[model samples]
Target: MARRSYKTELGCIACEDLSLLGAGKEGWLVDNPNILCAIDTHSVALANRSTILVLGWSDSDGSRLKIRPELSPIEAEYVSAIEWLVFDEIRVIVAGTSCGYMLIYSLRGDLIHKQMVYPGRVIKLRIHGTKKDLIQDTLSGELCVVTPGAIARFDGSDIQNMLLKWFEETHAHFWGLKPKRQGSEDFGNSHEKLPYQLWNVSKYGNCADAAITGIMPPPLIEVQSSQRYYCAVAIGDDAVISAFRLSEDKSRSLVGTILSKVVPATFSTISSLSKMIWRSEQTSPKKPDQKPQSFARAAPLTCLKDHPRKGEKLTLSPSGTLAAITDSLGRILLLDTKALVVVRLWKGYRDASCLFMEMLVNKDIASSSSKYYEPSKSDYCLCLAIHAPRKGIIEIWQMRTGPRLRTIPCAKGSKMLQPSHPFGASMSSSPYVPLEVFLLNGDSGQISVLNRTLDT
Candidate 1:
């Protein structure tokens, strides 16, 4: 029989060697440093076990920041996850530790903030943001911190607010422009502890990976207008897929209860002069301290149990409506989050890594448009790039309903990488930048971009 052949339509170009600038000068990264994880965007951040090197792509010879996550002398923890966080104009690097702490570092390598999110080890940090229209006020974003047994969410606006306050206070102190007031020593530390929602997703099994799919709008008949609801999805053993509906706790806090009783007692005392018996009870000077609580409840929505087939990874769509999950049985399942149903499935892709990407399908119309004409969001079509190591090929499949577009030969031990969303970038303010994926060859120590598309 003749040997089968593959096409070269999906090709990649060589990327710059990451060990060329300051990192190379300091002899920190070897010729082929065993990169455990990395994120490529405006800058490239490569992490090994303990160190992370970040540098910009615009200037090859520019300075690079080498960061080592600070750990206590008694604690032994290493970096588990890393992501670039954008707060409006300010950008920072956030790294998760094995001991369940989130460390935020400035671009200059200073530790900006650190907090213990969970008792269990942090599995991953996922950030999802969307802009429905061009005239939206700000991007609706949420940061999901995943652990073995739970997941936590930090609203984008809350983070931005906290960071802004911390920076302003630090600037004032640095310039000696602000007077030292009571509790000034704890000013910066207290500001970093932003309120977050946590949920226990361990009901099915330990979560290997999870994502906050989307935040649902409140119902018309809802009583609490301020409470926000969310939908979360997780994957692990015993249960291949599990989803939960997360909402804030409805119970009143100690402070709320105390204030409520005080208001009624004060009004009664004013009306009835004989109500002096309750005066001593309400005259206490000390207030009850609020302890750390989950402040949220997770109700099981659905559970898909598939024994002997554990889920390894989860990739969410730009809109978070769909999820692509890979299982141990060498299959990929496309799941709809809102409906909680598997819409598509592909088998025979063992050890396959997948990422969601976009391709410009209507090139003819794009070319025919005027030079200044901006292409709308509809010009591009969503696609999935599956890098199958066993077959040494990278296949592009149109998301849910389309056929496989093209298959490109790839080397073994190669992995596909996509830059995280353009954090803090407004759809109306900045020009549209289509999402793209890059190829990283572990054997060759070479990086390449997925620049070509079949268009059809």
Candidate 2:
């Protein structure tokens, strides 16, 4: 029998990488937009060095918002971190700098507030909508700020109240009304524990000799009526992904008082690492003494946190059910947040960056010709755009599985790298579409376009 080969297509080339200007200088090309919320438009917010740029997928004039001038004095403090926040009343962007300052901005590029969040660099930041603490001013979750030594949790109600006032004062009145009853959507309100608020704060990482790189709030989880909990994930200087359980109700936790869990010591289980994360916390504990009690992804694969080459960056699904980790070894590990396992692994990518793009998984459903006619939203698929910079190519892989749907070259014969800007790392709330990204024949693959359609 002949060996089967998979064909990868040419998707649109989004932008060029200037950061990769010199030999061994691949780190400069790290431009990622931390997506916040999607309503009328999708928000793509990220930092290039100390500069912060915000782009709306709906922006028609190519006008992007710049936070450097508004925030100012880059020489003193450069932007080291950024995040997006949403409330019932307003949407804003949150940023942190090397000098330990946190900046808040309105969606329209207005500087709402700039305050020193930390004394040192603010490494990781996240805000929640649910009440994570028993004593909170607002129902908005909590604002989680991570530094090199400790993680700070602040009351989210302050930001919510601030945004509420901003909306009423601006006269824009754009804070959309939330669903009266929660979790009414046919697909279930997966984002139930959003609009983060505050109740507690914890500091870690110093002992691990790790600088926190990323932190994420748990997906919506209801433990009791009107009482919810979150199991946050954090990864840093090491290959270990640490999980923390946060709740306002103060109910007994499945992982209560438990510390460290050991995992398997072999291969083949690489795909199951993420599944273990979402499992019941009451699983049997390891023997009295062993290696660090590890939280495996699926099962056998275990956590990638301390695996020699720890993950450097993380991207999550819009629904908060999945996580994509780009490790030091140029390997992208797709994780299932719900199952807490490594669903898939795609290797051989060099200096690669990834973005979650939309895909129309079922084209036939649109025509309504078959009995299996499904809703468009049901057919909606989340795809990974693995930007392989050195090879001038972008590989599109389906999530929860390692299926190479398309391979897009930056230039013909995959010449020089075609720098691509990250499309909204988060999916749009609007209808879905399947587009093709292509690299031009000339221009060293510096240019690319998203075609209206893709060839089957």
Candidate 3:
């Protein structure tokens, strides 16, 4: 690896950590103008001009970002949380807010649609890639799906619905358990009742803790046309990365299985010294119970990028890799499907303030550096963007080598120091060729585009 350096400049006033980043034929949009609010991204068609949907609260007016020249004037509000789903060249912006409502927006940033999605906040939103094109929306209190023709709502809450569906589909029936037991007759014609149990026999025993003791249904899966799909799951304290394939009939199936479970180490000790005490009534000395202590481990799944080619999916280095997950701790693990291990771990800090990775121009490296680097193998290394809070700086790591590549100091009193919360810091690449990097300034609500500046 060779060292590289670049310049930094200020761009737009995002005034908040961007919640969503996406680009299309129309343009790009950064939604939710405040710190850590759920933002949405979508392309919109406007007369002869193409426009990108930028959803955010106005800094001046303190109003949610909605289409100008309002038609229905339905102020979209998300009581709990919000998530965006894009499919069939259309953007489905769903917000789960108070009073069990969901606001829907098209790619054009128009409120042409609305639904009483849920009585609570929406936690997750997903869209299936099958030809049927089903939109799965999970709210804090319910799970429902909206299709081109009809919308199906499930009773209970989203979590419960997920648990039931998981047990029914994966043959892991134990997840849908409530306390109930059977009785058998004893020798004296008396009935002996067994302990009440929930969950099916196969999976109930494997559950690690009470957190997972409750049902966790599988996420609404997608089957892309590439015959492969990426699955990123945030599991208890840890994150999991897996790739799946779809049958010719479009049934989603597991592909090259990959498990990135974080295993933590444990230590124990016992006091060697004896204690002395005076008491009127002497009691027998009791032995202290000896048990080893264990530490719970967890990691965040930040980003995932699939290889552009096709072949053995499991062979991560060979076939297209499925996903890349980054944690707040700043550990970047690249999964190699074939080896079934993290092929590369890009370490920036024991923990990261914010990190982003994207595939950029391969030729830019040639003219920019004389290190005699090929655009293929090394070019595949997506550009690394990092926000180091300790230094109050945002640095771009172009190459994998020494020295600060490009550093931009954020304005003093910015909120980057806050723990990893939604919208603390986010980055996105423009969909156009010769990729453009956009950094969201959560504190100032400014969006800055990173471009090469020539010395005057």
Candidate 2 versus the native: TM-score?
0.54
Q: 2 or 3, which is superior by lDDT? A: 2
Relative to the true structure, candidate 1 reaches a TM of 0.77
TM-score of each: 0.77, 0.54, 0.38
- Residue 75's lDDT in candidate 1: 65
| Ranking of all candidate structures by their lDDT, best first | 1, 2, 3
lDDT of each: 0.72, 0.47, 0.31
Clashes of each: 0, 61, 43
Superposed model 3: Cα runs more than 4 Å off: 1-92, 96-102, 106-110, 114-233, 238-322, 327-330, 337-340, 346-381, 397-408, 411-435, 452-456
Write candidate 2's Cα lDDT for 63-177 as tens digits. Answer: 4565553334634666666676765435677777666556677656666655544346676665434323345432334566665533455556666665565455445323445
Report the lDDT tens digits of candidate 1 across residue range 237-256.
Answer: 87899998877764543433
Cα lDDT tens digits, model 3, 182-277, are 211111112121111111111111111111111112324534343322222221122233322112222211211111112111221112122223
lDDT of 3: 0.31
Error of 3 at 90 (Å): 6.4
